[model samples]
Every structure is written in C-alpha cells, then in structure tokens.
Target: MLGSVTLLLERLGARTRHLAGSFVYAVGFGIEVARQLVLFLFGKRPAFRVLTLQILFTGVEALAIVAVLSLSLGAVIIIQGLSLLPQFGQAELTYTVLVVVITRELGPILTAFIVAARSGTAVATELGTMVVNREIEAYIATGVNPIAYLVVPRVIGVTVSVILLNVYFNVFGLAGAFFASRPTAGVALWEYVAQLGAVLQVRDLLGSALKSAVFGVIIALVSCHHGLLVEQASTEIPQQAIRAVSRCFVLLIVVNAGLTLVYYL
Candidate 1:
C-alpha cells in the first residue's frame, strides 16, 4: 500500500511538472510568434501571400458555419426574449439583452470556439505530420526559420480571422434577431435599432475585440506548440491535434471569463 501511494504521488508530480512546462512553452511560443508578426508587418510580401492563403482557409472557409450558428442563436434568443420578457412588461429590455448577449459576449466566444474546432486542429495535425515526416528538419537544413515562415503566418491569419468572424457573427446575429423578432413580437425594425444603439457602448465593442484577439492568440500558440512536440511516430499527430483543441477550448473559456470580468469591473 505504501509503495502504491508513493508511485501515485510520483506520477502526480510528473504530471504537474509537465503541465507547468507546457504553459511556459506556450508563453514563449506566443512571444516568438509576436516577434515574427512584427517582422511580417514591416515588408514581407512572401509572408503576406501566405497570410492571405491562411485567411482564405481559416476565415473565408469558416463563414458558412459561423453564419448558420449566428442565425440560429439569434433567432432563439429573439424568440426567448420576446416570449419571456413581455410577461414582465419588460419588452423593451429585449434589445438590451441582445446587446449584452449577442454583441458583448456570445459573438466573440462563439467565433473563437468555431475557429478552434476548425482551424486549431488543422494546424496541429498539419504541423505534427510535418514534424513526423521530418519536413521541419528539412526546412532547417534549407536555412528556413519554420516559426517565421510557417507558424507566424498561421498565427496572424487565425488572429485576424477570429476577430473578423466575431464582427461578422455579431452583425449577422443582430440582423437575424431583428427579423426573427418581427414575426412574433411585431417589434418595429427602426425601434429595435434605436434601442440597440442607445444601449450599446464603445466599451462593449472594444471588450469583444480584445477577447477575440486574445483567444485567437491563445489558440494559435497552443496548437503550434503541441504540433511541434511531435518528436516521433505519425500516430501522435491525432493526439496532438486533440490536445490542441482541448487546451484551446479550456484556455479560451478561462480567458473569456477573465476578460468579461475585467470589462464589467
């Protein structure tokens, strides 16, 4: 029994150390990507071209799903808001609810979730496969900086895509909610617009942009870090991909909560 207890404690300690090291590695990865991004901004046409392709893959390719989700969520929120709030003689608060839920909160979080589900896994799997295939080493032998040439473009693309998709999500969501509300509540479009305009603040938009940007940064770093950890075997690719998605989901949620709290405070 004592032996078993000691063994369990050792395993726990190992896991804790691994977790701490991974966190530190992710932070360093983020910093390196940021440094490369600064360079990409200064006059890197090759990086720009790569960034465009990544944007096409991660952003434009993701529009349909984001649109469908936005429309569905907006309709549901509209239906629920109209159904429940009017009974309390608080029909006017519907716009406020929309502003708070769709604009300030769900828009960015949902966009990040979608990007993570779609692009994050793709990044990890692609990179892990490359690593397993020794393609990363080949790049190094060719004197190419894999982090700058490969990873930075992806990081920039995903960050931009997430932020843009968050904007798109909010726009589609608000518009869908307005149209959906019309059939049931008979609310005037102009009135809904006016109410939203009145209730919405600049800080709400800034907070959302900040949240999405930070979430994008986290997702990219986690995915790339896990992908690069593939030291042996092609079988590890899927495992790394899964780790990337799970870590992104957890980190995004935690960061979202922290940012939301800070916004309110």
Candidate 2:
C-alpha cells in the first residue's frame, strides 16, 4: 500500500513538473517571437526571402481551401436564415446572423484552424526534422542565429498568413451569402450590401481582427515551441507535429471563448 502511494505521488509530481516546464517554455517562446517581430519591423532581421516564401506557403497556398470552406459556410447560413427567419417575421435578422456568425465568430476561428492544421503541423515537422538531423546545431556552429533566421520568419509568416486568410475568408463568405441569397430570397445586391453595412459595427470589425491576430500568434508560438522541444531521434518528429497541431487547436478554442466573452463585456 505504501509503495503504491509513493508511486502515485511520484507520477503526479512528474506530471506537474512537466506542465510547469511547458508553461515556462511557452512564455519564453512568445517573448522571443515578439522580440524578433520588433526587429523585423525595423528591417533589422535577416531572411526576407525566407519570410516571403513562408507567407506564400502558409497564406497563398491555403487560399483555395479557405475560399471553398467560407463559401459553403456562408451559403448554408444564409439559406437557413432565409428559410427559418420569415416565420418569426425576423427576416432582417439575417444580416445580424451573418455579421455575428461570419464576421464575428466563425471567420477567424475557422481560418486559424485551417492554418493550424496545415502550416502548424508542417512547421513542427520541419523543425523537428531539422533538430533530429542537427541542422539547428549546424546553424549555431556557423555563427548563425537560428531563432532570427529560422523561427522569426516562420512566426511572422504564419501570423501574417492567418490574418490575410481570415480576411479573404470573410470576403468570400460575404460574396457567397450574396449569391446564395439571390436564389433563396431574391434579395437585391445593393439592398443586401446596405443591410450588411448597417448591421456591421466598427467594434465587430475590430474584434474580428483582434481575434485573428491572436489566433495567428498562438498557432505560430505553439507550433514552433513544440517543434523546438524535440530531442533526439527522427521518430519523434511526427509525434511533435501531432502535439503541435493538437495543442494549437485547443488553445485556439480556449482563446476564442475568452476573447468573445471579453468583447461582449
């Protein structure tokens, strides 16, 4: 009985320690990424080419998927809103529903999820493979700062890409809703645009941008952190990538809820 109790205590202690270490590492990673971003703003960072390529990979390459998903989502919302809202004589609420669902909520979150599932896992896998292959050490030996050259570009790329993709998603989503509404309710384009403009507040726009930015930052930091945590063996690369993607998804959800609550309050 005593032995079993001791074993349980040991396991709990180790788990706590692991959690504490992960928290600290995440904090430090965020700080480092922020510092690098400041440098980037001043044109003091190297690897502009790398940064551009990362943006293309994370943002441009993901555009089609974001567009398709957003279009479908918006069409569905508009169709349902048009069908159901008239029964309650709240057809005008369609604009409200569109603003709330597309602009304020689903847009940023879905964009983040796409970027996380795509680039986040890729970043983790790439970095983990680099670590396993000692490429990171090779950079250090050549007197290069891996954080600035490797991590900064990726961090910036992912964040910028996610933001841009979120904007595109919103644009496509609204367009989809417009097209879908024509068939369903025969709402005129100008009237639909007016309604959307009237229903969309500056505050909602600001909130949506803020949410996208935060989600981008979270995806970058979480992916990079997990990738860097890899130690020894190529077998661990896939595991780290999986962890990065999972952690990013969970963090995005939690942060989304918190931001939504704060925005309303």
Candidate 3:
C-alpha cells in the first residue's frame, strides 16, 4: 500500500512539472507576441487590419454574453447573501461579500469562462477548418509563420476582449447587485456602493486582470495548437476543437484556482 501511494505521488509530481513547463512556454509565447506588437505599433510590420478585426471579433462579440452573466451573477450573489446573512446577524456583510467576490474574482473569471466558451471554440473551429482545407500547409509552404499569422491575432483578441469584458462586467455587476440587494441585505443601495470604496482593493483588480489574461492565453493557445494538429480528416476537426476547448476549460479553472489561492490563502 505504501509503495502504491509513493508511485502515485511520483506520477502526480511529473504531471505537475509538465503543466508548469507548459505554462512557462505559454508565458514565453506572450512575451514574443508583445515584442511583435511593439514593432507593429511602430510601422515596422503593419498589421492594423488583423488587430482591428481582433478587436471587433473578441471585444464586440463578447459584450452581450458578459452583460447577461454579470447581471445574473450579481443578482444571484445578492439573493444568496440576503438568505444567509440574517442567520449570522450580519446582514450588512452583504456589501463586503458582494464587492469582494464580484469585483475581485468572479467578474474576471466569469468573463474569461464565457469568452473561452464562445471565442475559444470559434478559434478552434476556424483554424481546424483551415487545416482541413490544407491552408495552413499552403501558408507554411509560402514561408508564412502559421502561429504568427493565425494564432497571434486570436491571442491578442481574447486577451483584449477578456480584459475589456471584465471591466464591463464589474461595472454592470455592481449595478445589478445594488438593485438586487435593495429590498434585503440590510443595506441601502447607495450604502453598499460606498462601502465598496473601502473594501475593494487595487490588488483585487490587478489579480483579476492577471487571471483573465492568463485565461485568454490558454483559450487561444490550446485551441490553436489542437486545431493545427488536425490531419487531413474532416471528422478530426470537430474532435480536436472539442478537445481543445475542454483542455482550455481545465487550464482556465486550474489557473483561476491558483490565482485565488495567491489572493485569499
């Protein structure tokens, strides 16, 4: 029994190391991408078209989903707080709970989750379609870097989108929570907003941005990787896209959990 336990520990260690390595590689990719972006800004390599398209696809497309989620989550959290706070004789703590959860964590994480589900799946499907059509190979044959041409735009797209969406969500969520908690939670709507001024730290927002940024990276990178790995089979396109999104979901949750640990623990 001890031997089996030891073997399991070893396997877990290896898996951890592998994931850590993948994360580092992803970080490196982001760095390289940033460098290229700087060059693009200076007209060294003009890619305004790609960047504009990215903004449209990533930022605009995600607006409705983020708004709906933020409002629903804000309403739900307020309801939960109302239901539970009286039991502890601390109904006013609703303000603390709402600001902490919505502003610091859930706003960003939820935005990323929704973006990953929508944009991430779309990226995989598009790239997979390109692969099935032999376009990636043709691009490579023409000396175009596939990752630069295909992956970087979506990466920048999701990153920008997730960040913008988080901001929007936080704003709307606060409004929703204020409205939702008015009848209960033992605090006036204005009082809750004012209390948030004291409790919501800058670090909370920074942590949220970092978490969402990492999530954006995972969504684009994993999806693109799986998409590019698709062979000639058309059936493999859907399979790889599904696998990519699933892997991205797991990665996003793991990363979010790690960030939450850093903040709370």
Best by lDDT: 2
Q: Which order, best to worst by TM-score?
A: 2, 1, 3
lDDT of 1 by residue, 1-265 (tens): 9999999999999999998997788788878877878887785646678789889989999998999899889988989988899899998888788888998899999999999999999999999999999999999999888899889888889999999999999989988898898887777989888888998998888888988888888888888888998889999999999989998999998988998888878
Q: Tell me the number of clashing residue pairs for each predicted model.
A: 0, 0, 0
The count of backbone overlaps in candidate 2 is: 0
| Residue range 25-73, candidate 2, lDDT tens digits | 8788778777877887787757788889999999999999999999999
> How do these models rank on lDDT, best leading?
2, 1, 3
Q: What lDDT score goes with residue 226 in model 2?
A: 84
lDDT of 1: 0.89
- State, as a TM-score between 0 and 1, how close model 2 is to the true structure: 0.96
What CA root-mean-square deviation does each model show from the true structure? 1.8, 1.2, 5.4
For candidate 1, the 10 contiguous residues with the lowest summed lDDT are: 41-50
**Candidate 2 global lDDT:** 0.91
Q: Which candidate, 2 or 3, would have the higher TM-score against the true structure? A: 2
Q: List the residue pairs that clash in candidate 2.
A: none
Please write out the lDDT profile of model 3 over residues 145-213, one tens digit for every residue: 666666777777778888888889988888788778776555685677677777787887888788778
Task: Assess the local accuracy of residue 41 in candidate 2 as a C-alpha lDDT between 0 and 100.
Answer: 77
